[model samples]
Target chain A: MSRDENAAGRTMLEVDRLAKRLGEFSISNVSFTIDEGEYFVLLGASGTGKTVLLETLTGVIQPDSGRVVLAGRDITRERMQRRKLGIVFQDQALFPHMSVGRNIAYGPASSGMKRSDIEKLVESLASGMGIGHLLDRGPATLSSGEAQRSALARALAMGPDCLLLDEPLSSLDSGARVEIRTLLKKLNRGGMTMLHVTHDYEEAVALATKIGIMENGTVVQVDTPQRILTHPGSEFVARFVGIRNVYRGRLRRESDGTSLFESGSEAPFRLETLCEAIEGEATAVVRSEDVTLSAYRPDTSARNLFEGTVSEIVPARRGAEVTIDAGAMIVAMVTERSVEALGLERGNRVFASIKASAVRIIEG
Target chain B: MIISRIEPMHLIFAALGGALLLFIVAPLAGMFLNVGKAELSEAAADPEVTGSIRLTLLSSMGATLIAAIGAVPFAWILARKDFPFKRLVNGIVDLPIVIPHSAAGIALLGVLAPGTPVGSLGERLGVTFIGGIAGIMAAMAFVSIPFLVNAARDGFAAVPVRLEQAALNLGASPLRVFLTISVPMAWRSIISGLVLMWARGMSEFGAVLIIAYHPMITPVLIYERFGAFGLKYARPVTVLFVAVCLVFFLALRMIAGRRSHVEG
Candidate 1:
């Protein structure tokens, strides 16, 4: 590839096949991008290199093999200070020596803004962050929520091209976390392109426009919130997305080109398979909402009816969750109305119905 | 989880610590008790004592200024970078603080005395150490440097690198972040370190004694009075000097403490 074309190919922020080996544990061959104003969330468990990727983007740790392009410019060789990225750390690092006013004024003043303008901007930002009264107060006096707000306001005061948050809410209590998450969502709506790293699935669902699920050293799947939760690309994604009935089976394509997945065990329910699997051992991801319980076998040509005893009935969001042991674990999300109508109880026998299209197949 | 107020053990420790404090405070009491108005007037008229006090303040303050300027960059490196020989550098900072003051004095003399390479090299630059003001400053600086570096290092380290990165992301340069976020957040430690370094420089004796005996600082002056004349000759000066340093330290502490508490 010619250098110009390759350079043009770089997105607003493109990480080209990045890899960093630090002793035994390292990230490799990870690549992704963010647009000028996209809310990209890199979500993963602790120690999965999510923060590592964010740091690499910020030039904290230089990647060994990948190029980082920002706004169509090759910033691979650029120092961290030149990146013009705003970041909020987990601890809400505030300057102890500077008051709220001075802290907000810091970036603009240092960036060569006029002193009078900086003062005005500082006052406006302090009030905008709900700390106008505390402008004269020092950072050490602020509460955790207040401190995080100040940290965020200070970062935003610089008017960065891109913003990064390293688990800003990870350290807060539940109430503070919710408050911050809402604040972040509000900021995101106002055109702040952000790369937020978090280990919470709920947080990811709440704040992310697009989700990047990282495992080990690579992004296993990057998808919209609905796609990742409902149609995960791999078993790893399915498990993390809380899919209860994941059936590992073999694909049996018939002469008519119709596909059926023959799962292992004596009472495997036969159903038409929607997507072909990579290997003979295919996987199916089924969310609780996709499954339904039947008192008797219904008339359907799909051939996916199974008799199993109700194992457990539990509560979910505005609904009741019923677990049916139909050869495989079938978690059905029934509204409280249906739960009452069915009079569902543990050890009661019922037929479970799930259409093939509802089953998202993953190739091994 | 156990959220009771200060425990009995804490009270006991505080009482014992208070007694130990009195042990240190008793000398000041004696200095006040022994001093008459006549002695204070006589000591005030002694030009040698005044000159020594003036020189001591100048050299100590000068040493603190050197530490203040030199430590910022080095402290940032020590706080942020991971490199070979870092621990060795940190250990080097602790050497003068831990070693006997006389050893540090001798070390400074060996390096800065005329005929030594450093001494002759500095002399070529129109600077001399032996019996000179530069030697006094060097001795004081060598003894007090650790406080500055340590305080500054801890201050910078306490600042999350993420804040600086955030500043950079916002298009501010690295220097901008250091000046804006990192330095301000860490300023208390730096200021406290300066106070400590300045006070240490003021009290420095052994190191100053070996390098520049002629430019007598207050401590050395006190030693001279005790040997040549006696306590009656030195007690008044000692009381006055201690009182001045006490006021300085107390004021600086209150300001730094208030500022930090407000920020935090």
Candidate 2:
């Protein structure tokens, strides 16, 4: 592949077919390349080998097979101290015995940098992390957010070419989560390359430039965040990314230049969709937010409408999730105000409408 | 002010516990109270008594320092690694603590006698284990090393592994990680272990008596005085030794406690 194909410059790290077996859970034949200045996020559920992969990349856990190339050098055999890759763990893992300044300065001190230079670097990095005032405090005294920032500062003090973060914001409260998310975005804007792993889809949406969906032990899909959300490549990817209405169907071309999707053989719920692919088995998905709920049907341009009873109304953040059993299970996310206006409740008859363009087709 | 919080059961338990405490404190207090200032001064001025006390302190310190150099690393390994028969190695470390000190002395002699490999090799280097300071240290260390090893091991185990891994990722070599992170984090436990080992070695009687009686450490000197001159002469020396030990032990413990507090 040409180096310029990546949005950033040359690739900063290339993990080729890395494999490691740790008892029963093993990551096998995993490969990905992170370009310079690109914020690549590996999105996966827990127990999917995300942290193991990150540990392998950092040389904390050696891979059984494959090469780890960093900045044009093959460092598969290098020791963790020689690899120059910085990592922030989920728990922050700050040195409890050291003051915040000394913790940040640990990396440079280990490299035998002069004390004056180390202090200057620690100060600069701490200020950049917005934690300069916390320098004299011990790590145990800091809050979770402060500890995370200190960990990040410590990692950055080494001047690593690429930073590997494992769920950097998973342990923070929602407020701190947003703060750190903005901080990460600002860091990326300053031309820092990062490879972050997280399970939260919202976090991936907020921070990732490129997303790699992992399952079991392998990368199932790698694409831009927009594409991963709009067009998931697999059934697992579709369900994992919160595309709520995924159905296996057969697509057939109609004479009027559109396609008809027939879902099941028994009742055969059919819907009109926009697709140019030849007739074949496929999967259709629609985001829950795209499904609109109404108390009564009215004249509209939407192509698919079904009458069903509300099976569940679960309150969510800023909205309620309405599940309707319209011959097929469908979920719609509506704001609390909308729910109140429509007088929605369980067992209430409702109409679920979807535009033809909102239906996404994935080939089987 | 404090009596209002004390319940009837609390008073009963407190009386029982205080009685036990008095049982331990009354003897030591009586020994000191019985010794007149003149007798104390005389005992302090005695060359043999002072020499034996100095020898006891120095040799025990030597034994603790020497044992720690080997024991600390062994403790770290035991804490961090998972080798086959690790339990067996751990059991062997605790064996000295469980076995009688006289049995420990016999075991040491079995290996360090004149014709034995260790003893002859040492003799070639102009060192002997029997009736020498080295023998005293060996016996003292043999019985006291378990304290250091066990305490340091617990200390190292309490240090989170992620902290060490974080240091390694920050470009520290394994040795540097151990020295900067592991050792410093476990400093309290290691210091406690050293104090325990030093104190245990200082009071050792059976092992040192059988191994090297001639060195005349304070314990041996006390025994000789008790047997040769009865309680009259031994009481003053015992009071002097106990007083010195209490001062140093309290000072060392205070240092350890204050250091931990400051670091925390």
Candidate 3:
């Protein structure tokens, strides 16, 4: 709930009770605010109305009800051309009939800017996007990354108060994704307000100052990325943000002034936690990356430790996910070097260590 | 394993396709061969023959231009919008293609004959339709307009709607988007449709016969020559007319091809 200090407490765009119905899928009572200089990302899975919400904000789709105020102007009923909001689509819908330079200059030309000024604007924007040499080339000839850079330049040509991006990086390969992500971060750092929509949680974590989690066509939770990752508001949010270890358990206060948590059902296990909740049933969430693995047990400050067999080793983003079966299943993320150093393999006996503070508690 | 060799079915398909191609080529080849250079020269020199050919091209061109003024925008609507009776309207656009040509002329007569309100208004406005060039154009457009409308609709349909939306979001008005983005992207298809409509109109027989038989287009003149003077007279005009039509068709096609590549 706390805003980043760079947000400056000034709202650039606000959506109030926005409602839209397209056939059977409808988003209702959606409300959020994006401050100036903030990169707000709306994160959700497919079919969650992320693109629809983005298009509605861009004035491509009119809401059945509610108000959209942008830069202190009410634009609920404004036409798309007058809204002054720019969007970069997932496919990078550049005008194929025009060269990259003309594509970038389309907005400026439409506003009746001088031809020389428009050319200068196109050059400066293209160079900043690292596409300076591609201005005279057609969009069909460019690679996916270059096309996206051209699209971003086109959207930024008019120097609008805010920009909306609709799954811009979803269609790119990994290299292009990283390149565009870096470009987006650079733009945010230069004080450009942006609202990006994507299903990639890693993308949100890397780029957003504030993240809004949407579910079933509604904005369910909005907070800083750090808070949303460590302190999810609901079980769905926790699972969505990739909290790999979640258990339904009961909390008990130990005589030694620590909390002892015991899970229920088959494969029941107990762990020491730092939860302040009264002795009752609760949920515990632990991130996979927070768990450490070792071949032999040693004295450490981590309060909870379990000896189990390594059940599976799966490759992940820059690491191997090692699934350990203690009393209950626990997944730990370790680098490839660590996997080799610890001689990890399937059915290898291993010890998993987790700090008490790493165990997050969510009460029902 | 995948079969890489040609099968019996492939030979059968080739034979059937070749037979159809020969059927189309035989009559035109026979007419061209039978017409001596002297006969062709005679037909070309005849003012009546030359005037009718000129009239045919000019009237078809006029019909195409007049129809396109409205058809392009109407095609955009058909491609982009969903409205009540849209299916019905689409079916109606294709009605002329399936209906009997004489029946279409009769239908046109019901609304545009001299005694009808539209024809009477046209007469008062110095634009008579019955037995005039206007009547020929009306009949030609009535029969061939579907080609243009359908082609333009398909052309507009193939243009991604997202591009237009992007243009609108970039601060271009709707009218500007249509002029600069939609029409240019769909230009080749529209041109192809126009050429097809013009060619179809030029060859129309029954409708023009019913509406304006006096101001003879090439088809009507050929029909008249055949009915009166038999095979020898008709063959020369037919060969010459086909040659001229082929030349113009190829030229238009080349132009359309070049424009698409340049714009694309």
lDDT of 2 by residue, A128-206 (tens): 9999999999989988888889999999999898998899998998678767877888888898899999998767766
Looking at model 1, residue A129 earns an lDDT score of 72
Error of 3 at B51 (Å): 1.2
lDDT at A167 for candidate 2? 96
Q: Which is better, 1 or 2, measured by DockQ?
A: 2
Chain A TM-scores for all candidates read 0.67, 0.70, 0.70
The full ranking of all candidates by TM-score, starting with the best, is 3, 2, 1
Docking class of 2: medium
Off by over 4 Å in 2: A1-8, A244-290, A293-364, B1-23
Quick one: best TM-score, which candidate?
A: 3
lDDT of 2 at A150: 94
Query: For each candidate, what's the DockQ?
Result: 0.46, 0.66, 0.64
After superposing candidate 1, which stretches have Cα over 4 Å from the reference? A1-10, A23-25, A35-37, A94-105, A114-157, A168-192, A206-209, A243-292, A295-364, B1-22, B98-100, B120-128
Q: Looking at model 3 chain B, which ten-residue stretch has the lowest summed lDDT?
A: B235-244
User: For the second chain of model 3, what is the TM-score against the true structure's chain B?
Assistant: 0.98
Instruction: Report the TM-score of chain B alone for all candidates.
Output: 0.91, 0.95, 0.98
